[model samples]
Target chain A: MAQRTPLFEQHQAAGARIVDFAGWEMPVRYGSQIDEHHAVRRDAGMFDVSHMTVVDLAGDRVREYLQYLLANDVGRLRTAGKALYTCMLNEDGGVIDDLIVYFLDDTHYRVVVNAATRDKDLAWIGEHAKVFGVGVTERDDLAMIAVQGPQARERAVGCLPPAIADAARDLKPFSAAAHGEVFVGRTGYTGEDGFEIILPGDDAPALWQALSAAGVTPCGLGARDTLRLEAGLNLYGQDMDESTSPLESGLGWTIAWEPVDRDFIGRQALEQQKADGAPYRFTGLLLEGRGVLRAHQTVITVDGEEGEITSGTFSPTLERSIALARVPVGTGERCEVEIRGRRLPVRCVRPPFVRNGEIKINLD
Target chain B: MSDIPGDLRYTKSHEWVRQDDDDRVTVGITDHAQGALGELVYVELPEVGMELSAGDACAVVESVKAASDVYAPLEGVVVEVNDALADRPELVNEQPYDDGWIMRLEQVDEDELAGLLDADTYLETLEDE
Candidate 1:
């Protein structure tokens, strides 16, 4: 049996096809996934992302603790409500999880981690937190919904309290605000303009229905996966995990190297890898031939060095297959992906295939 | 419940076969199969002249989520492949039994078709799953 969200019955009412994802029974789609994917790109779409874990850190040493725990320095979040995306890495430099931490204040901050990595992430945070005596509280009493796309903010705000709605409307990108019992973050994984709202768990069903009534299409995890892939956002376990380092996984920019003495975890190993020349270069692959590109497919460069695709999918926005792969450094513009024993040609390029309702990379 | 045509025959792998004539049979995935796979993005159909043995994995169906193999139910020579799926693969999701027909196989043994499950038996198998 799998765990369910507060809006599970609402999902069933909307005719969703449920699937087991990360030990939770979640809606994969309400109808056609491709249509739902397009809805998010073209207009407003909402997703029940309540399964993601939210942890609040409170203590005078919270900032110092986070500076030691994460690859990206939370010290950059100078203003309240500002959010930073970062990686939690193991001592040897392998990525434990990629998450967003919102700075509410010096002593109170909130962090959201992936659902699949919830258990380990909490354990790791708990273990490291004891040294700082930071209070780590899981926010299971809340539920989250992400309304995304061009008209997402306006529609989502209409469903919130007037004060919270006004605060949400004034939010900048990567910012969060709390009014009364509601917390709204102007952050999302879909590479679109949106708001991720966290409210009381009991209010989820009513909010879901309200969003639907406001013409926000109810999207599911299927569309979420494709949208994030098109946005070049990495999926936690698929794109990177405990075995891969941030440098090789296209997450080097998230590491803050300035104030070099901060001595964050995995800093030494990452610095050493940087000094030694990273072995693999993470890049995007566009299939020039027919057939879908999928994870675990081998990519062979022109010079014969091989790499593996971390995440691959048919981009509904581009109408072609795209993937993120880590190939040997110096691998050139072209490579071949082995799909079912057939080597199909592909072009190597920068990621972010689409962003802000526009194509970021040249399809031609 | 998925629509299972009584006149058609089904393989345990979720393919449905309809006898177009004495030796030629039209094949497509069952409605249950397409529903499970979700909206398809691409289909790799066998060439019209390709020869296939029973249970041979000849075609491939690629959905947005993943790719699945489409196997041959009996020995036959491919007579026709659904060309429309090359451009519009969602036909398999929208109309799996009609326009979504995957291929036509000629020279199949009519006697072997009896070994395949009928609509009722196929529904029972689906329930067991």
Candidate 2:
């Protein structure tokens, strides 16, 4: 049987189309997915992201343990509530999982990882933490809600407790703060201003009801996927997996090469790859024809080289099909994608294709 | 409740058919089909004059969530395709019965039309699913 989030009843009440995702029964859409997509781009929308795994690490050596476990250095998170995005890598430089770590204090930090990767991520973190005597506590009792859009912050603040609302209103992007039992972060997957709120699981349904009563649209994973794809964000399993490295996944920027003496996992393999220069190019593609772009489609360059689309979708914001493809290094501005046995022309562009509810790429 | 016009014929696949006075037939997916598929972003119609057998995959309708093939309900030669849907595929979602008609077949076999389910039978099929 699949697991149910705290907001599952609310989702059913709103007529959401529930589907099995990563062994959990989750809403794929409420009504029209495109309408939900537009809701996040033009106004406020909320998603029940309670299935994400939240783990708290505590000990005097928690910070040090994270620095060694993750590719991105957590040392830069100087202020409490400051968050850093990073990839947990295996010793072979392959991605284990991508996660966000929030610095709460010198001895305590909170990490949120993808739900599908929960078991492995927890086991990996637990094994490494043992040497440093850090405690890893999975907080399944918590539920997360991500409210996003241009008007997201304003509407979301109205649904929170007064004191937390005031504190959350002042939060900068990528920052989080706690009030009582609720933790509010000014961060989101959609390329819009928003807040991700984590609170006790039992209180989630009431909060969802309040947000809906406040006129924030209840969106689902379908809209979330489209919004994230338009923003050029990577989905863990589709974009990169245990066999893929950050250097070739467009996530090299997250790696911290400083503090040369730090011997993190996969450091040696990454250093060797960097010295040799990464071979594959990670980039975005805009379909120039009528057909919808989809993952696993073969991409053929004008010069006869080949690649594949890792994630593709019909971008509602841009009114065009866009994709993220991994191609041969030095792949140029133009390529052709094979859709249904016909080669369609495509333009290579630096992602994201849309941001802050605005189209970033030139259609013409 | 889904709208199922009693006068029209439907396929188990969710397409509705209307026989015209000229012996030709017009076809489009039902309202329930469009609602299930969500907002369409692209529609790939078959070329006019193309030959099709009953149940042939004649066209495709794509939404943000997925792509589905629209099968021909009866054997015929395509006489006209909905060109308007090339630029505005949402017609299938907004006006599936009228403006959203996918194709008009000129040479449909009269015997094949008899095999399609009536509105009541089609509604029963939907319930079974």
Candidate 3:
């Protein structure tokens, strides 16, 4: 049986199109996916992301353990409420999951991981945490909602408790602070300024209603997927997995290579792969024709190198199709992707095809 | 559930055909089919002069989640295809019966239409499955 979020009835009340995603019954879209996508880009939109799992690491050695466990060094989190985005790796130096970790205090830090990888991430953390002696507790008592866009922060402050409303108003990007039972973070997957609110599951519905009344549109997984894709954010299973290393998944920048002496898990394999040079590199494709790019379609460069698209979609802001593909490293500025036996020309460039409600690509 | 008008004829593949007095048959996906496919995104209509076999894929409908092929119900010539859907595909999701009609064919082999199901028969077929 599929699990439901605390705001399941709230989604139903909005006439949402609900579907089973990663074993959880959640809204894929409410009314129109395109409208919801435009809402996040133009104004404000909120999503019930309570299906994601949050783990709190509490102990004297919590920071030490995170530094060793995550590919990105968390040592830079000197101030409380700072958040770090990193990928947890397996022995093969492949991404087990991409997650966000928030440093709350010297002894306490919180990590939010993908819902599909919750069980494995927990077991892996438990098995490897013995040396540091940190206690890992999953926060099932909490539900998370992400309110994102240019106007997101202002609207979300109205729903927050008065004690933390000032703090929330002043919070910068990639920061988190708590007021009473609510934990609000100024972080989001979309390339928009927003806050992720974590509160008791019992208060989720009322807070959702309040936020909606404040002009925050209720978005769903459908809009979330397009927004993240347009922002160049990687999905755990689709972009990279246990077998696909981050070195080839456009995530090499996320890894901390300095202080090579620190033997993080999968360091040796990543080092070797890096030294050998990656054959297939992740690239962004801007479609130049009428056809929309899609995953698993064959891509052939002008020089005859073969590649494949990992994720693709129509960008609402760009008014065109964009795709992410693993292509031969040094594949030049122009490439071609085959759609239904028709070869369509595409341009290769860094992603963020649309950001901050504006088009980054010259769609001429 | 949206009502599938009794005057219309349906195929097992969930397409509805309305025969006019001029002998041109207007075609659209049944309301049930549109309900099964969530919000329609992109649509590919057939060419106006194309000759189609009974089971040939004449058009394509895409939703945000997935894509589906709309097969031709009977052998016919594509007399007209909906140009409005090129820019506004959501018509299939909102008005699958009237404004959302996909195409109209002039020369349909009426003999092959017997294999298609009536409103009650199609509902019964849906129930048996």
Please name the candidate that would achieve the greatest TM-score relative to the true structure: 1
lDDT accuracy of residue B8 in candidate 1: 97
Using lDDT as the yardstick, the better of models 1 and 2 is: 1
RMSD over all Cα atoms, model 1: 1.1
- After superposition, the stretches of candidate 1 with alpha carbons farther than 4 Å from their true spots are none
Give all candidates' CA lDDT scores: 0.93, 0.92, 0.88
Off by over 4 Å in 3: B21-24, B35-39, B48-51, B121-129
Give per-residue CA lDDT, model 1, range A1-364, as digits (tens): 7999999999999899999999999999999899999999999999999999999999999999999999999999999999999999999999999999999988999999999999999999999999999999999999999999999998988998888888899999999999866899999989999999998899989999999999999999999999999899898899999889989999988999988999899999999999999989899999997789999999999989999999999999999999999999989998999999889999998988999989998777
Task: Rank the models by lDDT, top first.
Answer: 1, 2, 3
Q: Candidate 3 lDDT (Cα, whole model)?
A: 0.88
**Clash-forming residue pairs, model 3:** none
The CAPRI classification for model 1 reads as high
Candidates sorted by DockQ, descending order?
1, 2, 3
lDDT of 2 by residue, B59-95 (tens): 9999898889999999889999999999899999889
Per-residue error (Å), model 3, residue B90: 3.6
What is the C-alpha lDDT profile of model 3 across A118-170, one tens digit per residue?
A: 99999998888888999999998899999999999989998888999999999
